[model samples]
Target: MRKQLTQFMFSILLLGRAVAALTPEAAENVPFYHIPSTIKYADREIERLNKNIQTKPRLEDSIQFKAFGFHSDYLPVLSEIPDQPRWTLDLTFETYTGIEELFLVPTMERRIGRNYNKNAPYGFPSHFRVSQVFPDGRIQPVYEHNGKPHLSRMPLFIAFPEPRSSSVRLEIFKGAVEENREFFALEEIYATSFSYIRRAQSVKVSSAIESPPFWGLNYLFDQQTNLGQPLGPKNPSLSPKQQKDFSANFGHTPPGCAEIEIDFGENRPFGWLILYPALWPEGILIPGYGFPGKISGTIIPENQDGLRGSSSEIENWTGGSPGNNPVRLHGKGHIGRWLKLKLSDFPQHNGDYIFAMGEIRMYGNGRLYPVSGIRLEGFPKTEFADHMFDGYVGGQPVLFFKDWFFKTINGNTARYEKQKWEYTRQALEQRLDTLLRSTAMSIAVTTVISLGISITVIRKNRRKKIIELRRQISSDLHDDVGALLGCSMLAARHLEETLSNETDILKVRRIIDSTTKAIQAMRDIVWVSSDNQDSARQLAEKLEETLEIYSGKYEVSCKHDHLLNLADYRLQFSEKRDLLLFIKEALHNIDKHANATRINLQITVKQNRLKIIITDDGCGFDFRQAPGQTTGQGLISMRERANHMRGIFTIKTSPGNGTEITLELPVKKKPSPLKPRETTNESN
Candidate 1:
């Protein structure tokens, strides 16, 4: 229990350090330092972390450090066997020693792949951290070197640490939010084992026998051929060089069996065997030689000969057509000094029969063995055998082959972590995508609804203005022009009957003058409502001119004040119509009713509102009595028109006081359709 807590704390410290040092600038230095010789298998793996920290890596996989804080722990990172649980990463440092750093880099060592992991360029030298912990729970120097080598092989299976007097604890830390800091993670420092060096030794092969298609033996068990050295280029034809170096034969002559035999110096235990089929061009097996249709492999005692023990297999092997064929050795395999593989009853080729092979390899005693002696029998002397045994005994075994196996395991392990990460990320992004789609859809719906409302309002307002204009025009023709036309008709009839009455002629002339005046008045109304006269400046000038013409009938003086840039402020057709008509009515009242003389008009606009004030210094009438006693539109038409326009109108007048009228209207409101009044303009 105490050990678990210590390891937990160590994990926390290292993670904290990782978070702080996760800056892009700092990640460049991580994973570049060297590790002790007791750790490296053949080359340096620490330097594999590139200096490009431009994109931080991300790793989200589960890991545990069971053997990290203490010794006497045994667990593998992973077991290649499927039934076993995946190994967790663990590490240990020398107790009471110094602090160290570990860099975690994320890389899929391949090309710009069209596949999943290959395209993920994220998670490079992803994470970094410094560790300083001692076995006694004491602090150590910050940047110490010469720390014990804690990792030798790539971790694949769960493994425990060997016992020690004092064990080291790594500092605990957490990851950082900085993106560049996310490339990779070092879950724990492993307490590397040196015992593998002592327990592992070289295996010596005694001889090779009748592994006919002699060149095929070299293809399979060439000891000089190490990791990364695959079979040389294949050929369908035996070139002079191909015959000299690679070609081999395996068909039996007629009587004797065809097979290959390998001998170890003494009795040994066996675990597995592998055979690599020599490939011709396009991966076809060579034409003259094919795999044995019936073969038996047995482990016999070193002193005894013949198949005298329980054999693992004695049957026809198939599916040896393309690549390698590997079989696990079973039964009491310890008695064998020779692993004998016998082939007979070859299947017919072009005309004859043969069983050909490329290379053979065996694994036992915890190490890959080298073939010491090779013996080929039961064949004509003309067939040639290259020095196949020499290749088997030339190179170092563990460093050459096992290294490849372990590295492959590591790559597979990384792939496992990657698959899990992708699944989680994809699920989260899908939910986010759904939310964004919903928001966009809602916004679009709202915009469409608002547009519908706006169009309706515009059409309705236009209809209202049309109705109002027609009523005003109808009233003008009815009250003024109709009366004149009637009077003229009467005068013409009277003159026609009498022929020469002076009184009748004068009456006809008066009628003609009245008709002309009424027509001009109607024209003036039409002109006021015209679009061309929409500007305030134009309205003001026209108003002054109307006042001048009306006041011409009296000694009254009319003055108009000009508002600056008021013309720039345009008025709608309805606003101009109503404003000009109201002014005209007031002027008409002063002309025929108000007995006094001075009139002043001021027009101004501010903040999109137009204000017009008309003041008359004349004998005024009562405001209250004007509504009932007055004729024509009186106060009703003015008030109704003002309300329809969404403006305010006021009249200040009394028996002895001058009258003042004011109207304020908004420039943007569409004119409301106001109902016409029944009354007409009689007098003020």
Candidate 2:
């Protein structure tokens, strides 16, 4: 009894420690955190944690500092840009003890961290100061953004204004405090250990700028490499003038007229355009990156706007504000491939007479169409003329509170973030509501049926009723809902075929393809839930049809049902559901990630043993390698489903060798099964 008591006390102590390790108080004691590997469960765990944070935003306050530091490293994992040494800082706090720690870990940050920046520099925090600390502990060249002498919010990231000054110091004033409070709490400084990171050269696609054909032709200007870089598809506008001396790329259309055209490939809903003379870095415009004179731009409707056309012209913007303010052109809801921008007028400068500009921005789809589909006409070819599109944009790539356009466009950075959180919260609440209703109804039905069926074989009758309910749900989920989804998909396809514009066709096709995939998923769920689909042979048949349907979405060829002998291996509810999900996931993997062209499926059962094999000829990957953004979740899910079914799952593949997956699950009961149905690959 003494020995047993001692063991019990020891076990109790161990359990206490386990609980302590998970507590906020205990986390403060541990200084070091293991860097998270972005693979398998870690990615999923981070996603789950982030969703929780997004849904219950107030939960952020409850989070301990150490926990925040540990989790932030994993939650918002972003890919790192080459050559740019990414730096991240943390303001650690212990919610329970009110303890805090400031950390500056300038380690070679991975792309997949909570503070990860997908678009470096551009996507970094808009407001924050950066300082470099030499080995002597003296900081230099204090910089400030958003008129604040402070560091950014928690998990703050910033580019070294001077990349050579590796040793850095950050002065954080208020860490993630409520916004717009005057120096409320953000202020602190921390030292850093600059670890050396040698990364590969970043691969960004670019090409030499070719002068686009000018519609409503006026003249061609000099070809200079002065136009700023393409600032992504989403960046709305750039500063109109140069603050630096490097701006020199400029052009002027003759006294006659100037016009440019953009082909969006389809009828895209365009809203507005901002035309401003390139300010210093926004474009290669000379001197103050400002306009030399006032000018206006209008969209020509082929025949209107005094163009060689027929429709009325739409005037968008006129230079009527300070700093050569950009004119905002509201196109209403213009849809078509061809969009025209014509310079209406300009004041002559430098002893020449013509309209001129520094940069032009097209705003639609909540982003700027920098240079994806635009053509320029009429250039007075000069040595610097080609610089207009040489991809060298310099200006504030992002909007600050001071920007006039911010209010014009209704920019709400923080509030919208909360709005996003609210959206997620509402979604979760809806899901919870659905789950509660389902559980309550199920329980009520089960209890009433059990109590009323006392005369009927209670246990057997309840099970029969359950089976009937499942059948009804399955039928409803597929026959009714699935039919609607299928019809929508077909309608989208019909629209694609009937549409004259290739752009519209592509858009419709995308919708059709997505809807078709949804239908496949729905059918799989229904197949698993229906009581009649408990047979193992039915599983095989479902797998074959399912693979073909999914593969068709990727435009891949699929061959199935070359079966030898099919046995009715009956499965329980759990087995059937898991198995069906497994097959669905496998097919989904091939369709989305495999890049395969042809899929071959085999369902073979021998001596009451069941085996289902799916082979695909595509750019196969090594299963043992580290998972990337594409294959990580798929591989993890496939393995997890196989484990749930207690089945043997194996994949065989190598780079360029194609992939083959085989699953063998235990048979519950063997029944006399029919011979394999002879079906060709094209039978679907």
Candidate 3:
């Protein structure tokens, strides 16, 4: 028991260790730039405004497309740029540097209401390569992608080989599409060096879109993303608790613009204003749902007349759909006590416009200020206007950006590890099942072989037993018939001696009797040895023949023919030999000692038992008196032989009564082979 317990504990320990190894570590918090930094991109002209292709302010923004119009000449003709119009993006650094990893987001990060090709970008090259440009202008290939179509929402993470360069270049080949118009769209790019990762900066593109505010190269460097604020390992949006007392429904309204205003009791200098999009309970609204497609706002000073026609302004700003992420507006070196916002293009709900928001956070002097009051104007409902600043999004607390990001990343890592472990466990179980089946088959084969061997051994043993039985029969013939023959020889020698002394008739008679006994013994041996005489009725026939031969010397008669009725019964070798010898001994004693005139024999079977009775009409002796050597020896031999055959022996006689001997034995149907004779006390 102790040994089994130890083994069980060891197995449990191994299982626990395996589980621990598969467990994923917590996600690490990373710092990124919240404002545009040293990043640069190619500048272009659009609507008389200088723009770039690297960045866009709105989630639905894209770069300008180039296609040959059948009648236009301003754009390149389709034939002129059939293999032309390839675009190249380059990032240069002051000194030679190498990056360990790179992340490329090809399309918008938020998956709210926008629709596009999810398997690869619409015009992305089927194949692309990233190369390192050294100071000597030697281009060394770093990584190449086969560009097989796959799900394209998460950033494509790539690791570079040991490479160092002053600049990196990404070139896209045209002709991905058969149409004359071809263009590539990318959301963002990030590069990691050692443990530090930052947005790609100082980019130079060969051709780009020129749009302001929305599709501009500079807007790409802004760290705003659909991931929203970094969340911990737990997603608050999935399981959230409402922190605000919501009594009014702001989702139903007419299709029109609405204005909201907030007042900070005293004039306070501010640098940033962040707007968080509204989310509804039970998926009533998607993330960023009900957010206006276009928004214009301004900051007003406390001394200004805060009315419909007030002209006093601190800073003016414009914003668009921030998606799930909150949009931050930077102040233009101004101090304001009143801020007003006008929103348009509310999403439709039940054929009507709906408007809602999560929260509004204002920062000034590196800290957040508690707003004094909020006012909603030109809306059907305004009772729950304070809900916008309830410090909750979708009924969940908005965690710090870094905390939320790490938690979300770590959750994904843990989930991936669990999936891998599940697959491995299933594979191992299958292997174990196969092994068990194979072992069972081996056991079955071994059992069959063992049974065959056992059967062969049993047959060999049976053959040996038959040989031993024949030998035992031979020994019995030598003991019984040889003794009788020796007696005959003695009688013949006596007769010869008497022949010279007047031809004694008694001696001659003795010779004939001895010879006859020897012949009878020989015949009995032959009958017992014969395999064909195994039935009980055959034993009676052989006994009757012995009586007939003996009748010549003494009268003998069978009282009944009951022995013939036992034809179905059989006797074993030992039983037949003992029964025949017993009867012969009784007759020899009577012939030598009793002056018998008539002898009667009776044999019968009753209830599967055989009974034999022999009687003589002669001078009988006392049943308890001791007899002479020869007579006593013969009598004891008869009794012992009968006992050995598992039969009962009885003698009834008196001085004047005739002697009677009876034997009863159970009949054997299927007799066994001969066995060695057992030594009895009668012989001793």
Candidate 4:
């Protein structure tokens, strides 16, 4: 029996494949029919009678019939049908052309009464009715008027028995004008048997209902096969095989109808199932099959009407009412079970066909689990205590204070460091100023002290020089005068002794004359020193007198000239003394040392210089050797006097030649005051 059933199912599947192979245009125009064995006799009798009593012959080309049958109990377990003394027959017919004008030849069987094992009338009945099956799997009735069938726009038909019964039989036929035969194509048919059974009030809900992942599915509505093909001529009816083939081609298994099994393990606690029905196909908006239902789990209708025949106990399982309806299943026992979905009714309302599933949740015993491992919709809120505790006991305040203090201290330190640098710079500048001042004061003090010392030393040196000059002058005067006196005495003594002889008397007279002149010249020198006359002029007068006195001894004569105005001459007293000494020395040298016949003394003054020239016609010595050979005191005194007066003295002489002494002393208009000094003793 199982093998036979399997073969039958295989045959049905093969028929669907054959229908799919037809060309789209042919399939669109073709009509299909389903004939059951119970209805076959009625249809065949009509065909046979029409063949025998042919008038304007009914053409086989006008229509064709194909047949298929199922034992009707093959799907008994699935359909929940009961076994009884019952039989059922299903029929379908299709018309290609003249669909409005076509009619089914009803059989003589009346629908009012039932009799077991009794045959009904065999001829076509006068009353004909037409119906259609809609795409949503709805069967809608059509009215019969004046023995003619009125077809509804729907594509499904439903005919109920006069009295409710477990079994039913139906016959169907098709008729169209012969002329429209060429426009007719017959394609397929479909049939189904429904058996009545007492339904149990207690409903069983599955433990788990699994849904497929909701990615990449397109939604559609009223989806028919070969929709693009042109509608061809209609046919009146379809055979059983034709209906099966047509349904196999045009009918579609609804999305989500695939049975899915879910296991939540054993002995799970009761929980609430929150299904997101929004994930279903948009076709859920349809009126019948697509609507939510309570048969599989727990359903809350989105529409108010619920399901069709909602008052009937059997239809109470259909779920749509209206408005904001939601489907929720409670109890955790439903976690593991297999669920089968029905989709045939979805096309009645919404046109879309996409299938989807939103987040599903299960709440049980203070625990929640997601239907597909999805989490709750929103993030969980944190507790206030957690935040408060985190803020405390972390030493965050100390860290913050340290950071702030460090920054503050760093800034202050930087500022103070800058100030310190500036202070150091200021101190250095002050020190530099102090050092410069100290150096300048030291230099000034040292310079002043040095200048004072230098002045004192210079003055003392000048005083010593003045005393030396006075001594030198006195010594020079004494020596010259003493020497002249000695010569005068000797001459006088010789004259007295030689008075009796004539030749000696002349020599003695000459000697006595020289001595008297010498005494007079020395008196003149003394007179000039006391008189305070210009030293140069006085010295010139004395020199002339000395030379005259020396003339008796050596034939000497002195001449003096004063060219400078006496009042205008500015010689210092020391300089006058020096000039007098220089001239005296020259005259003395002529008297004592020059053994010559005559001497000449000349004094000349010009500009700031006084020149004294003494020439002697005497035996002169070599001047270079004279200073070394003789006591050069006179020469040394003359040179010293000249140097004291800032003058120049020169001697010109040679052996056997006359000697000349030149003294050139510069005279200044405003001579410096002579330095006073105590006289030092000098040997004559």
Best model number under TM-score: 3
Q: What TM-score do all the candidates reach, one by one?
A: 0.36, 0.29, 0.43, 0.26
Give per-residue CA lDDT, model 2, range 326-384, as digits (tens): 33455554543456655444444464443344445555654555454556665343333
Report the lDDT tens digits of candidate 4 across residue range 1-684: 234335434544543543443233332332222112312433454354343333111111111111100111111121222222122223322211111211121112222465521122212212323344333555433433232432211112233322222221222222221233211111111121211111111211111112222100010011111111111111225332221100011124343332112223232343444333221222232212223333343222222343322111111224332111223344423323212122222232234432222223344544543222111111122112121111111111111111222222233333333333344334444555666799899999999999999999999899778657655654566578757777777866866675787887777777776766666655645444442455555556656655665555676566656534434454555665566667667777766777778777777767867777888888889846666734577777778888887777787788999788887877755465789776767732
Distance (Å) between predicted and true CA of 440, model 2?
Answer: 41
Report the poorest 10 consecutive residues by lDDT, candidate 3: 34-43
**What would the per-residue lDDT of candidate 1 be over residues 1-684, giving only the tens digit for each residue?**
234335445544644554454333432332322212212411222223221111112222212111111111122222122332121222333322121122222222233454544323221211112233345665332322222222322221222222232222222122112333211222212222221111101111122122323222123221211112222222224443333322234444443475567776666676556544332323333422344545567765554564345534422344233222222223233556676777665655555554444456665554566766666666443232332232221111112222333333333333433333333334334434555687788888888878877888887788667757765775676566767666776766666567677877677677766665665666576666455667777877777767776565554443433544665677776777778778777777776777767777777777878888887777887746765645456567877789878899987788878788889888743344689777757832
Q: Write down the lDDT of every candidate, Cα atoms only.
A: 0.45, 0.46, 0.59, 0.39
User: Over all chains combined, what TM-score does candidate 3 have?
Assistant: 0.43
Off by over 4 Å in 4: 1-582, 593-598, 604-610, 618-649, 653-657, 665-684
Runs with alpha carbons beyond 4 Å of true place in candidate 3? 1-87, 90-103, 108-152, 156-185, 189-204, 208-257, 263-269, 284-287, 302-325, 363-372, 382-386, 396-406, 431-684
TM-score of 1: 0.36
Count of residue pairs whose backbone atoms collide, per candidate:
64, 62, 11, 60
Candidate ranking under TM-score, highest first, comes to 3, 1, 2, 4
Deviation in Å, model 2, residue 93 alpha carbon:
99
Q: Residue 522's C-alpha lDDT in candidate 4?
A: 58
Candidates 1 and 2: which is better by TM-score?
1
Q: Whose TM-score is higher: candidate 2's or candidate 3's? A: 3
lDDT of 3: 0.59
Estimate the TM-score for candidate 4: 0.26
